[model samples]
Structure formats: structure tokens, C-alpha cells
Target: MPPLNDDAIVLRTSDFSETSMVVTFFTRESGKITCLAKGARRLKNPFDTAFDAMNVCRILYYPKSGDVLQLVTEAKLTERFRVDSTVAIYAGFHVVQLLNHFTENFSPQTALFDLTKIILNDILSLNPICRSASLEDPPEKLSRCLLHYELRLLQLVGVAPSLRECVECGEKIEVRRGARRAAFGMREGGVLCPRCRPGKTRVVSLSPEALGALQLLASPEERFWKRLQLSQKTLGEIRGVWNQYLAHQMERPVPIFQWLKR
Candidate 1:
């Protein structure tokens, strides 16, 4: 096929040969693509900046029929996100990691792309470390943000857990004590009612506030995130639920959380 022009964000890059590299990018128009960047490792390479992870660029490529990799012709950097803050840097990596794991090649994820860009911009602008430090209680706020992003990402990918009612008996759960003990059956893809928990089942405990926070995060409005708040205990509960849900769905544990724990 003839070379085509597209705008994309660099997801990853690795050395291919003496001077070239195998680069993966998620494009605004063409979705995820793996392209061979000939001579990208050379000092005088024109597409040097475009090969950096998280950098948005415009690329020209020729995709042969039934070929796994595309041949890159030209790439021009459009946005070089200078992430000076540590939190911002980690946030950027989290976005890239999620896209790499969850999305299939050539599948359109325009909403996910836009959401990631906005989140990255927010992380770059705010002092996440300082914000966490000054809080009445501090407990890995950056990690919490990452978890929130993951939950929303899962929703966008059509795998978010059902929290409204029990997936088993379709009963609306009532909050008890300070928390609501809902049985999150990973196999069933949602919560289980009290009556339906007769047999052995996997479940995650969530506080009333935590459930509310989850609902808010799953909402449609991007600006609605500003009004959302959660306590330390609630955040921890939500994180556990997200981790369990993601692991069950993906069949592999997310290592990014391990790095963030440090």
C-alpha cells in the first residue's frame, strides 16, 4: 500500500539492528501500530524525537497487506512532554504501560487516547507529591490516581465490574456498618448478592464511600473527577478491587503497581 500520514503517540521503542529500531505507536487515526524506523538510532536521524515514549508525533508509513510491521517513511515530533516532576513521569509511564497491555493492534480507542492525554497533562501541571504530603492523611496518592485511571480504562475497554446490584440475584446491595461487603465474583463479572454467596466465590470488600467513588470515576463527565474525594481506607479498598478485577480479566498481574509501591 502507498504511504499514509497519521498522528500518533509513541508507546514503546527498542533497538532493532545497528541503526534502526522497532517502534510501537498508538495513532489518532489508525490506532496501535508497530513500525520499523530505519536508522532511528543514528545521531543525525530526523525521527529521533518521535521515537521517545509518550511523545506525540506525525508519522508516514507504508503498510503491506497481511504484514505484521509497517515501514516508516517519515516522523515529525508534535509534542515533547517534558515531565519534570517524578509523579508526572510515573503517570506518563502508567498510561503507556496500560495501552501496551490492554489494546489490540489496529483497534480504535479514540476515547482512551483522549483521556490519557488529559490525565498526563493534569499530572504534569499539578504537584502530586506535595498535594499528598499536605493532605490530612497520606497514603500513596499517586498510586491511587493510577488505580483510578486503571478502573476507568477497564470501563472504556468494556470490562468494568458491575457495582450497581448483585450479578447473581440482581438484588440491590445495602450498606452495612461503615462498609458494604459485596461479593465481587470475577467469574460472573460483577457483584454477588448475600443470598447468592452460598457456594465458594471470590469477593472484594468495599466501603460505602469507596463504592460511591467507583461510581463517580465511572461517570461520563471528565470534569466530574474534580469533585470526587475518598478517604485513606476507602482508597485502599478500591485499589484491592481494581487489582483483583484486572488480574482476573488479563490473566496476569500488573507489575507497574509493584514499581509504584516503591
Candidate 2:
């Protein structure tokens, strides 16, 4: 067949033999794919010797059927992320993990791929030093970035969490005193209005503050990031709510959230 060429982000890399390596890439044209880079592990290899998580690169590969590995003929690095904070480092790891786990092989995810590149670029540009940096709180800021990216990814992958209304009854959740205490319906797959609250046993109270944070994260406003600030309580609740929602929806836990906690 023809050579597949695309802009891809390195999601994973593993040594396949003494001199060969298997690299997993998430590309704009192909959602997720693996290729065997022959002799890539040598001291000086033709594959640039620069495959790592978060590296954006141009890749050319030849496909093969079944369990046989596809040959990655060429890989040229386009961008590499550099962040000062350990949390930021882990956040990149989390991004790669999500791609490797959630994406389907050879299926194009152009929007998600573009957005993923943007997320990594933005994270490194901020050059987060630590949670105690003078610019902002490290964990708080990085977590918000990661959460925001997750929300966007969820949208791209057709699993966006419902925010403005109830998932069951189509009732628009009112942002007022009594109605502000909305219930997060995990199985129902979104926030449930109090009127439709009794059916689900896995429901948890989602405060307006926490919901507001989710709204901001799901928002497209560029200035929102600069103005984004979350109190510890609100952040915790948002994390908890999304954690349950994501876990229930994916039928497994999302380990990336733990990176923020650390």
C-alpha cells in the first residue's frame, strides 16, 4: 500500500529488541498507530533517536496486516515539550496515556490531535516551575489545564459531560440557591436535575461552584485560562465529580487525575 504520512505525537515507546523499538503515535490523520522503528535503539539511529511522550513529529510508515508490526520508515521531530515542574511532566504523561488508551488504531482524530498538540505547546510555554511558583499555584494551575484538556478531548471523542442541563429529563439546571445543589448522575451520564434525582443510586451532590468550574473548563474563551482560579474546595469537587463520571463512562478509572494530586 501507499506510505502513510501525518503529523503525530509520540504516545509511547518500548524497546522491542536489542536495536529495534516499538513506538506508538497519535496522529492527526490516524488516531493511534504503532510502528516498529528498526535499529532505533542503536547509539545513533536514523529515526532521530528522539521518540518520547509529547514529542510532535512528522512520521512516514508502511502498514502491515495482523499482528506483524508496521515499519516506520521515517520520523522527523517537529516539537518537543520542556516544562520545569514535575507535575507538568506527569500531566504530559497523562495526556499520552489517554491517547494510547482511549483512541482507536488507524482511525483519524484530527481535531483531538490538533487540540492535543495545542495542549502540550501551551503547557510547555507556561514553563511551570512548581506548585509554589510565583505565577500561580502549581497543582491548581496544572490540574486545571489537564482537566480542561480532558473536557475538550471528551468532547472530541463524543463523550462530553453534560453541564447546562439534566441528562435524563432534559431539564435545564437552574443556577440558583436551591437548584444549585445539582446531583451528578454517573450512570445517567451527566448532571441530573433535582426533579429527576430519585432513580439513580450513584448520584452525588455537585455544587454550583464545582459546576461553574466545569463550565469554564469546557468553555472556548481564551481569556478564561488567565482568569481561571479555583478554591481548593471547588477544585476538589470538580475533580471528584469528573472522576466518577469519567470512570463510570469509560468502565475504568482515569489515573491522570492522580498526577494533579501529587
Candidate 3:
């Protein structure tokens, strides 16, 4: 068909031949795609180092009709993620991993792309006051940003956990104003009422504070960091529970997030 030209975030790249590379990029207009870059390893035209992860570039490629990988004709660097802190850098990597894992190939996912781009810009600036950073601990702020990204990505994919109600019974979750009684089932994918919860195995004890924080972060305010007052314990609980549910959905644990934990 015709050439595809778009802005893309480099997710991964591997050597294909002496002068080319096989690349997987999360494109703004085209979702995730894999293409072969002929002569990309050469420095004469200067595309050699442009395919690194977190680099945004404009690319031109010719598509193959069916399921075969396309041929990337050209790539021009756009924006590079200039990480400012350890947390921002790690968070950037986590965001890339999530997008690669969650996005379907060739699907039009503008929202995911937009969220990913914005976060990349935030983390790269490393401004202690970056919009995503609300806490004094830079790492914690970045970690929460990662969590925020995961929640939104899940929602875009239509499998977001049911935070407001019991996934088993579809009843609204009630926390009695200040009680820490909500239970989150990894398989059920949301908070289960005490009545709906059968047993404790494979479930996460989601406290009221954690629940409230999750709700606030996942709300439509868009500037979620401003609304957060999450304590360390609450952040830990949210991270643990959401990671569990996400792992269940993906049928495997997210590797980058696991590394971030360590």
C-alpha cells in the first residue's frame, strides 16, 4: 500500500543483519508495530542511535498487506527523554514496558499514546516539581506516576479494575466512612464486598485509605497528582493490589514493575 508516516516511541530494537535492525515502536497514530530498518546500523545518515527506547521519532515505512512485518524507510529523531531523576528514569522504563505489553498491534490507541508521551516528558524534565511529582520522595512520586499510568492503560484497554463496586456482585463498595475492610480479588479484578468475598487466598486486603487514593488517582480530574494525599502505606497497598490484578489479567507478572520494586 502507501507509506506510513507517524510519530512513535521506540519500545525495542534488535540487530537484524549487518546493516539493518528490527524495531518495535509504539506509534502515535498506528499503535504498536514491528518493522525492519534497512541500513539503520550505518552512521552515514545518522539513524544508528535514534532507535533507543523512550526516544520519540517521526518514521516512514511501507506496509505489507497481511501479517508480515513492514519495511521502515526512514526515521528522524523528534524528542529524547532526558531523565532527571532515578525515579523518573525507572518510571519511564516502566511506562514503556506497560505500553508494549498492553497495546494491541495496529490498533488506534490515541489515549494510551498521549498518556505515555505526557509522562515521558514529565519524567525526563526531573523537575522535583514536575506535575507528576507531589511527594518529597522523588522515587515515590515517580512510582505513583507509574501506578497512575497502569490504571489509565487498563481503562483504555477496557479491563480496568472495578474500584467503585464488587466485581462479583456489581454492588457499590461501601467502606463505612473510615473502615479498612475492602478486599480486592486479583481474579475478580476489583474490590469485593465482605458479603461477596468467599475466602482470603489470592486476594489483597485493600484498606479504605488505599481505596480512596485509588479512586482519586483514577478519577477524571486528569491532574491526579494534585488530588493525592496518599501515605506511604496506602501507596504500597495500592501498588501491590493493582500489580496483582494486572498480572492476573496479563497471565504474567510485569517484569519492569517487579524490577522497580527491587
Candidate 4:
């Protein structure tokens, strides 16, 4: 087939042979693709692209027949996420890893792709503003960006947790004026009201602050997230909820979670 061009974020790269590398990308036009990049292992490769994780580039590749990996002929580095902090860099890794694992090959996820790109840029931009300050404090911008990206990704993929209603009994969650804390059923895929919380397994309790922040994160209005802020305790609660839901959905451990939790 003819060479296809698209903007992509490098997800993972591994040496295929002495002089070639297999590079996986989550692209804007194509969801996720693995391509064999010839001479990619050389000091000065022909593709002229760095296949490092979290790097965004414009790629030109020839699709192979059947199940064969595509051949990437040209990859030009369009953007590199340069962040000084290890926390920032790891946050970016977590974003790309989520995109890599949640998406399917050749399936177009334009909205998710766009969200991933923007979140990466947001994580990168944090370094300049917080250069001297520590991110260990409450109201962490990095945590907010990560949370927003993960929430949007699940929504785009159609597995977003049912926050508005109880998963077990189909009751409205009354998020605005209900109990101070609520139960979230991991397997049931939504919040569980007190009436339906009996004998439930794999559930986590969410504070009112956490639930409100999650609603804002999952809001259709983008400005809600931009103005949203969370305390360290609330961020921890939300992250726990995300971990449980993602674990239930993905059915395996996401390696980046280790670094992200730290």
C-alpha cells in the first residue's frame, strides 16, 4: 500500500534487530500501530526521528499485508515533551501508557488522541510555573491533568464509570446534596447508594469532595475542569477510585501506575 502519513505519539520502542527497531505509536488518524523502523537503532538513523517514549512526531509508513507490521519510512520529530521534574516526566509516561493499553490498532480515536496530546503538553508546561516549588503539596496541577486525561479516555472508550446514578439499583446518586460519602462498586461500574450497598464486593468509599471533583472531571463542560482544584486528601481519594475502576476494566496491572503512585 501507499505510504500513510499521520501525527503520532511514540508509546514504546524496542530493538528488533541489530539495526532496526519496532516502534509503537498512538496516532491521531490511526489509534494504535506497531511499525518496523529500519535503521532506527543506528546513531544517525535514516528516519531522523527519536523513538523515545512520549515524543510526538509526524510519521510516514507503508501498511503491510495481513498481520505483518507496517514499515515506517520516515518519522520527523514534531514535538518533544521536555520536562525537568521526574514526576512530570513520569506523569507523561502514564498518559501515553494509558493510551497504548486502552486503544486498539487501526481504530481511530481522534478525540482521545487529542486529549492525550493536550494533557502531555499541559504536564510539560507545569515545569516552568512550578520550577522552584514542590509538587508534593495540595492543588497539584500535574495530578489534575492526569486525572482529567484518564477520565476523558474512559469516556471516549465508552467505559466511563456511572457517576450520576447508582450502578446496582439505577437510583440517581444525588451528587449535589446526598450523603457526605458514597460507595463506588468496582465491578458494578458506578456509585452505589446506601440502599444498594449490602453484600457488595470490590467497593470503595468516596468523599463528597472527591465525588464532586470527579463529576467536574467527567463534565461535558471543559471549563469546569480548568477551574477545578483538589486537596491532597481529595486527590488521593479520587486516585484510589480511578485505580480501582481502571484495574477492573483493564484486568491487568498498568506498569506506569507504580511511578504514578509515588
For each candidate in the order shown, give its overall lDDT on alpha carbons. 0.73, 0.78, 0.77, 0.82
Q: Residues 76-179, candidate 1: write the lDDT tens digits.
A: 98877675655566567878888778888888888888777666665555554534442223335454555667777888888877877887778886654565
- Best of the candidates, TM-score: 4
Model 3 clash count equals: 0
* Candidate 2 TM-score versus the reference: 0.90
Segments of candidate 1 deviating more than 4 angstroms = 127-144, 174-179, 259-262
* Candidate 1 residue pairs in backbone clash: none
For model 2, how does the per-residue alpha-carbon lDDT over 71-158 read when each residue is reduced to its tens digit? 8989998898766676677678888887677788877988888888988886786563453453234557666787888888888788
TM-score of each: 0.87, 0.90, 0.89, 0.92
Which tens-of-lDDT digit does each residue in 141-179 have in candidate 3?
556666777777889889898999888888888655677
Cα RMSD to the true fold for all candidates: 3.2, 2.6, 3.2, 2.1
Candidate 1 scores a C-alpha RMSD against the true structure in Å of 3.2
The prediction achieving the highest lDDT against the true structure is 4
lDDT by residue for model 4 (1-262), tens: 7899999999999989999999999989878899999988988877664688888999999987666799998888888877887667667778887888888888998888788888888887887654555435412777777788888889999899988788877888765655658899898888998999999898888877789899898865679997887777778878877886887899998766754442
Q: What local lDDT score does residue 247 receive in model 3, on the 0 to 100 scale?
A: 78
Order of candidates by lDDT, top first?
4, 2, 3, 1
Query: How big is the positional error of residue 71 in model 4, measured in Å on the Cα after superposition?
Result: 0.3
